[model samples]
Target chain A: MRTEGATVAFLDIEKVVFTYPGRAPVVDGVDWRMQAGEFHCLLGRSGCGKTTLLKLAAGLLKPQSGRIVLRGGELAAPGPQVGFMFQAPTLLDWLSALDNVLLPVSLQRRPTPQDAQRALRLLDQLGLASHAQHHPRQLSGGQQSRVALARALVLEPPLLLLDEPFAALDAITRAELQDDLLRTCRERGTTVLFVTHDINEAVYLGDRIALMHGGRIVENWTITLPAPRMQAMRHGPAFNDYCARVRAAMDGAGT
Target chain B: MNPTPMQARLLAAALFLVLLGLWELVVRQWGLSALVLPAPSAVAQALWSGLASGYFWPHVRATLQALFLGLAAGSIVGLLAGMALAESELLERVLKPYVVVSQVVPKLALAPLFVLWFGFGMLPTVLITALICFFPLMENTLTGLRQTDAQRLQLFRMLGATRLQTLLRLKLPMGLPPSLRGCAWPWCWRWSASSWPSSWVRAKAWAPWSSPPRA
Candidate 1:
């Protein structure tokens, strides 16, 4: 993908602080920003508040201090512009794949003929067209995750937040989904803020990677690698170097 | 081809007849009196004549009417009470004690009160049945609703569903199986009410020396 005109800021997080009651801040004094059409990954250990940061951006949680602005609008609550894929697929087990994909629009009371077509197109794009009539329990884990991805994207949201979306899958399925997600997000120009603990995944998919520890972003690295990233890239020197740097940063932060 | 449940039931019935024949032979050899123990054949004759003459139909219909009306009223009230209690902690706290007390109180004692209130017709019978039926339905529905997966609830919130929408779409669907199970027992109770009284009288006739009339 070309990098031209992708420098415009799409989301800005400024001096955000959040804490559970009677506890230390889970996200403390964090400042971060993402550019339009960029694939960013928040890499951190468990309980490091990477998911908390994603929740804040998704407007699922409010920061006690500082501001979160999305597309120049202040993030207040969940809206149609932002989509979220939780760690679990969270597909309604009773709903068929097609209905699950159409849930965001249906919940918003905006499902029209165009929205139905869009849902079908999304299922096809995710290679799930044939399974549209199947329930979530009848689908494999990989298929369920794909359906969830379709649900998140069917509304044509500009911003997508994924909280360890592939953490439950096997390595082979995870790799396949990682590549599919990268290609799809790149083609759609969707600004993705994804959370993951895997260093290799952060390096493979992130255009810019942020390492978070103890509720703060300790390091941020931008990958200047060419698009159409392949598995062979993992063996390349630049990818290895980036992984090593991220690992060192994680170790230094004692996370 | 799969054997139909009806075929299975017929096979069970044949086995039951064989057992009944052996019991009749043993009783005849011991010279059991007709008043003390009417044979299975006699009972069958009574049942058939009762059916052919339509003498049982009115009683059967009356009992069924009471059972069905009671079931419907009990289920609806139980479902609404469970949902309302689920929505408000204060209501649960204030009304839970009364619900528990009602379950613990014997229905035989409560039956007279219902008869006094509604009089000696279907109303008293239906009211008694409903009182007997409500506890299981309410408890099961409440448990099912309260136990909905928290992760799923969070997903609904993230999807921007209102609280009512979440309850209707997610929680209600999840509670359906348990609620249906709770509703099943009223059917069994209906059948028992038809058969148990006659069966108890038959047993008493076989034990003739038990007790004389008090007055």
Candidate 2:
């Protein structure tokens, strides 16, 4: 969960519509706004276009019509300003963990020594310092996800877009990673748009949650639970209440 | 029960010795000419004399030079062509048929034509060897480049990577292992290629003694 901050719109998606070739609109007339430093989750069922919308925001896909503005300018193409995490970790199997984290920098030019140090620091922050030299094949699913997270955050982008990054991990590992992600993003004040189908996960990590159904956002909630979300909070009545509300909204959308 | 490693080794050694003895006896009894089938003992003796006199060194050097030079040239050309074809659809469509036809015609068949054009010595041999070595590496490299993970490509796109950066950083590195496997084809072909030139063209200093071919 993000701490309270001044209400400044960091990303503005207004009536954004996107349809694949010979297919119906996957993201249709979607309007969304996020304040700077917000941790927002796009909660949805499968094929609901939440992932499509996230991709559109990341500039990986273009909308059929509508403007996606970031920091008061059009976001026509992906740049260093937006960090992205795919559904899978997507780490290069040939590269060591440290090298994978340094990819964003190395793609442009030879990485400076400071860039390497920063990548190492990010890995350390994710509890992967010792595994820096280890390749993706040597790492567990959880460790690989952490490395992907470090890679996403390496450039210290102002906006982070993640599409179910921890969906593949086991429960205990997922919880640990959620905590790590929350703490890291909060420290950096990186505006996050996290997409997930897991209601509990959405409640646990988001400052605000938007329920997307049939390529449109059907419900939005500003989570009222106290800040500094803890593992214990998942079991609390407040958290369950939020999850229930989101679940009801989802069910309503299905009907 | 499976034989122990030492037992296996001894068994293999005994089999080899028995075969060699059979070969020696058959040749002697049948009055076989050396040209028809040289005895195993004769082969061993020749090997010993050749090495002992250092008569084989220059031939070995020549064969090695052709093998290495042809391999290096063939592989570099194949890799570059593969990169170009993989990057451009129009180029692949236009050049791929010619490339395929070139490979379809046997390299051995091409050796005589090469000798006619380039004349004797290493040049014609090297050309024939390089032609033989080219195709497999190119095809493998192209397949590898095209087979890059789609998700990984998306990741690169999201990072605003330039076309060159995407090719070098993502496509090329990912394609290397398969392309290296392609080198195996050229390696095996080089041996046969090394001997073909001397048979077709004027005998180089390293040419092994052999009967002339029927016209």
Candidate 3:
């Protein structure tokens, strides 16, 4: 909600509303703004429009009533400046891990040799270089999701939209991914909008957390927990305080 | 039934012999003429004689040529039409009703009209073969394309892949092979097996009755 000065918003959703045919609005007139390099988590219950909001921000869905603007232009349709990672890895089964990472590059242009090298480097960063030639099915669940993240990062888009990307993973793998993402995005200075149902996950990873209920954001909090996002942060008093606040905000908020 | 490969083969052979024996008995007991319903032995003898004389080779070659050509041509039309329907909602809306209606009409009824328009040659028969084959290919291909992974499709769109790029990079790889199998393996087999006989290819042999088809 605060942009400080004359900085053009990296991403903006102004009174956006979306609904399925013959149904009530799934995403009501909700407005959100994210500055560059901010890692924001959208936390909510299962049917609380979190994924819909992420999709709207990613330019995969059109807001039925209002609009979403990205990088100073109306994001009427999906464009190259945004990256999306869904709940599943969605790696092409026919392509190798490295090839999966390079898919966006290959789709937009004839990827140069340098582009391929960059893809390999991304795989290396994700610790999947050894499995570059392996198909998606050969990789474990956490590994596949990491590959998905690598694919999303291939373009180094200014904004990344993730929809509960790690909820399916075991706890240890989830923590490692959270840490890796924390270091990687902050270093790259990428703005991120991550969706999740897990409260601790939000507290663990978000620089700011927005809690959505029914069709709108009911609460927003800037978490000042110490970073590097290690395991100790999960048990810290500040972390628990933020969690309790989020829980209290959820009580009888949406029907 | 419960056994090694060799035992399975022996069981198949035993069933074949018993089936032939029953056929032979039923024809003999009914006192049916050979022309109406030939016994298995009579049919085998005719096949042996036909082979010895090399009488059916040209017809066999003609049929195979029509079949493969029909398959290749039909596949192209079917896949392209299916891709169009999948990529554009407008095309799907415009074309799907006609496709469903075409399927409802018996394809054999169109063969005579084709013959009337093109004359009684290989073209008419080839056209009929293609017509018979394309429907299954189109239907199966449409199904495959419609069934592509929603997650992958969203990824393709969000990455700003062009429609052509999405078709080539995502849709074809995911849909083409399954659609090929759907039409080529089972659906086409059942439909073509039942349909091809009523088509023009069979007309030449049956001019009162051609020799039973070789395989």
Candidate 4:
């Protein structure tokens, strides 16, 4: 995504700390901020609390020690402005692909034809337009993940929180979806905070990358790559440089 | 010919006749009392006569009315109770023991008392049917509601789904297909009430044996 005004902060998570009772804190005291339309990736290994941090942002969990503010409003719960996608496809398997995308709206009222049209358009954008009526079991793993991505975006939330949503996919599908997600988010100017363990994904997708170690963001980088990251970008020097930086931070933290 | 449908049916009919013939021959050969051992043909003939005379319709209608009313009422109540228990831990803690206790005692043991209170007509029979249906319906529906995937529940929370919306959109749908396996059990009980010899067992308990006159 090309930069417009990068000055406006869309999400500010201040000194957040969270723990499951009687255990060590999963997310230690940490501060992070994001601008509108910026795609930031929180890269970390398993159990380092990246997902917990995303959940806190989504208002699915409350941080014990700090607060998360969106658009100057302190969030006590998940509002309409933020959309979340979990690692699992998390689509209601009983629902069709189209209906699953329409789920966010369906909970409010009977989804109007307009809502359905919007869902169909999103499926179309994700290349799942033709499989709208198919059940989740009928779709391939990659196809199901793409449908989930469509569902996450169907609400047109200004902020999207994705926690390793495509971790289970094959390489080719993951790359294709990463490109689709980047293009879509870039076009809509959606502020995204995506979480992942893969160095290559964080390097390829994020406008800025934050590496989490031991429950805190230990390293953060503003990627200066041009818009429309391509498949060939993986073999490029700049991409390798970003990956090395992320990997070095990972190894340096020894987490 | 590779067993055509019509031919298969014909074969079935022929076997049925042969079985009846053997039954009749065995009864005749043994000279058994008809009351003790009616032949298959005799039973079929009696059944046909009852149907031909329209003698069975009112009785059938009465039984069906009881079954449907019992099934519908019992199922609706069971679902509501199940939902209430599943949603509230307090309610589950308070009421689940009572449900378990009720289930532990023989429900059929109470059926006769219902007859005494409600009279011998449709009300008592309907109560029996409802009692037979209540347990499975409540248990399965509760299990289904409780078994909703945790991730899906998280999704509901993220979507800001209200309690009703979460129950309807997520829990209800997820619980259905699996709970349906056990949910079907009530229907079996309902049919057994109508078609099976269950009433015979009841009657044996409720009525005195026929041959006795004590001096």
Candidate 5:
């Protein structure tokens, strides 16, 4: 693979390896890189270590070997510059939508007037400004996910990590959030490393899809489809070709 | 079924009236001595006089003082103990047996011992009240603290919250309502009565005086 220093590549993962205590290595020597403002997806079956790799990249898990560099600096503990959205909404049920979005700010104990204004603006952008006072229980699954997304993005982190965030939503809601997430990330020029098992979703959302099998990345394909991809892209030749390649890669690896 | 406040009050009043009428009828029909079984009217008169003479205030005050003191002490100790146990498994293992034994021992039996150790006045009463009050607060607070959602804890850790921050912001808040409920109002009332000596003043002062005047 050619190593080009593009202005876009924000994260570099070189020969990363991880193994749980008393267990075999879940992620063994994976080399992956993504550009700045890129939406990359890790696609695989369950237990393929896609989630584990995402955690490693987010600094939630330390790699036993190799290194992950974020903007040229070694990734350490999760900081304000990196936002993580878990599989669950992970919203504090007692807190209002606005308060949930402000949690990281409160934890850091550094919310300026501008930060508050930014939070409000982000909620507004996410279509949750009117539901600021509502609790997580009051919102639908889609709305809750949106609020979670708003919370994740409110801090304006350069790197956003999503772990199967929309896996729990219904089909229609998932599709809607997919589009919303794509638009939001693109507008902010945020680099997103998303993990999902859905092949269609991987192609639909990811600018580059990396297929993982047995804790290793066997294929990394970059999608060159046009910007603002529509649902019709799924029926196009490019989308079909990417899907076929990824499927073959997965099957070839006996995943 | 949940009764409305008005319905509950009406039911209580009807029960009180029925009990009073039955007592009155039994005493009248049996021609019992006033000393043995005072008429409902006589008891009411005595009660009124006791109230009017301001004899009940001092006892009420003493009882309330004991109750408040015991409640404050018990709640503080219980909360601290519960939090400590929740935070440390070694401490929990060492103390769990003693806590169970203390809770099981009859409080009334221990009352005299408390009096013997602490002496008369409000100390024994407050100690007894605290003993009675501690169990619920400890149990409830401990349960609440332990019942914290694991996912929430993980989320807090992921958000870079320290252990103390997680406890204070998440576990403690989650446990508060149950802890408050555990310290029921009835326990407060009992503690008040035990701690305050005022409730006994009217009974003790008037009992001797109620006998027929010397010839």
Candidate 6:
């Protein structure tokens, strides 16, 4: 949370490049940055490397070239300062919901009563108070995703990297989760790098959308939509216009 | 219609009695020797005499001792070796061949070599039993650890979990059920091994005892 200067970016990715073994570069030399409390979405088609870029930002993967710095410090590996959400809920089935939420704290040492209390509070905040004692199989997919969201927020991490966390949910559930995510993240002022292929989702959730093509940022847009983004805004002309532009840009990039 | 629990129990008991009666009648009619096929009554008489004369106690003690001791030793060692093998790939690569060879050579063949080293007594037999129980548990533990969900592992990595923490909190707990199954499957093998050692020990001594089988 400490800042070296007023001009220092919260999260900075500088000319990072990565490739899997025996494959072409998935994330070809890319440079990007996010300011404190900014919501940025990386939008791309399948296999275009948006997820790989997010992983690089989270320090889950090392770049073949260049560097990534968080809070003006070089990112070497995954640390508690950043929270990550995978495409699937990825909850441990053997543990109860509350125990799973407290896993991050419990990993280093025994969870103090305060940690348990905090985890319970997070579950309650996510409307999962009653289901705190349930195992993953006992909960619905949407509920599981909510728990995963709470886990990502439990450390009160300054930066969050999410890889299409709601892609599997029904439309209504997805909308509700998006609202919950926006409200919680805005209140905490967490800088988020969300990866998704959905242009509408990017337009709806992000303050800025970065269109990625072939492992590079092809276009970037600053959403000027009114604050407290409402469900009604999705039908507005301004929202439709932004979605249309992003779609066209994606099409052009694909070609 | 399906029978109730009590009826099912009674039916099983009645069926057992009928089978026993048929066996007794066939043996008596054929004038078969007890050495070949003992009748139910002959078996009961021997059991009663063994208990009344107190001839069965030491044999029973020896057998029980071997059974419990072998299972305890084998299961514990197997579980630990499994944990070790699962934790380090280098350790697995360095030692896996020997582990496989130990299992590959039949225990029956190894019994004599154990006798040569430990002498004709309970120790060699227990060693063989322990060796018999080792492979399944180790294999199961390795499999369970390896089979952990990739996404969950990624989640752990993202949460800043150390290697030890991941093993204790995630891998070990996940591997336990399979490890227990390893214990269960070898139970029948344990019983056979219990009786097997005494005969195997006698055969090694070249002095076959004429005593009836101890139950």
lDDT of 4: 0.85
Query: Any residue pairs clashing in model 4, and if so which?
Result: none
Compare the candidates by lDDT and give the number of the best one.
2
TM-score of chain A of each: 0.95, 0.96, 0.95, 0.95, 0.93, 0.96
**DockQ value for model 5:** 0.16
Off by over 4 Å in 5: A1-9, A252-255, B1-46, B178-215
- In model 3, what are the clashing residue pairs, if there are any? B205-B210, B206-B209, B206-B210
List where candidate 4 sits over 4 angstroms from the true fold. Answer: A1-8, B1-25, B178-215
Identify the runs in model 2 with alpha carbons over 4 angstroms from their true place.
A1-8, B1-31, B178-215
TM-score of each: 0.85, 0.86, 0.79, 0.85, 0.82, 0.86
Error of 5 at B133 (Å): 2.4
**Highest-DockQ candidate:** 3
**After superposition, which runs of candidate 3 have C-alpha atoms over 4 Å from their true positions?**
A1-5, A15-31, A64-69, A252-255, B1-14, B17-49, B87-101, B109-116, B177-215
lDDT for every model? Answer: 0.85, 0.88, 0.83, 0.85, 0.84, 0.87
What would the per-residue lDDT of candidate 1 be over residues B100-130, giving only the tens digit for each residue?
Answer: 9878889879888888898889998998788
> If both were scored by TM-score, which would come out higher, candidate 2 or candidate 5?
2
**Model 5 lDDT per residue over A163-249, tens place:** 999999999899889988998999999999999999889999999999899999988888888989888888999999888888888
Span of ten consecutive residues with least summed lDDT in model 2 chain B: B185-194
Per-residue lDDT tens digits for candidate 5, residues B139-166, read 7778888988876776676677766667
TM-score of chain B of 4: 0.71
Q: lDDT by residue for model 6 over A39-69, one digit each (tens)?
A: 9999999989999999899999999999998
Per-residue CA lDDT of model 4 for B15-94, tens digit only, reads 98898899999999998898999988788899999999999999999889999999988888888899898899999999
Give the C-alpha miss distance for residue A116 in model 3, angstroms: 2.5
Clashing residue pairs in candidate 6 (N, C-alpha, C atoms within 3 angstroms): none
Going through the candidates in order, their DockQ values are 0.16, 0.25, 0.26, 0.24, 0.16, 0.25
Total backbone clashes of candidate 6, pairs 3 or more residues apart or in separate chains: 0
Overall local distance difference test of candidate 1: 0.85
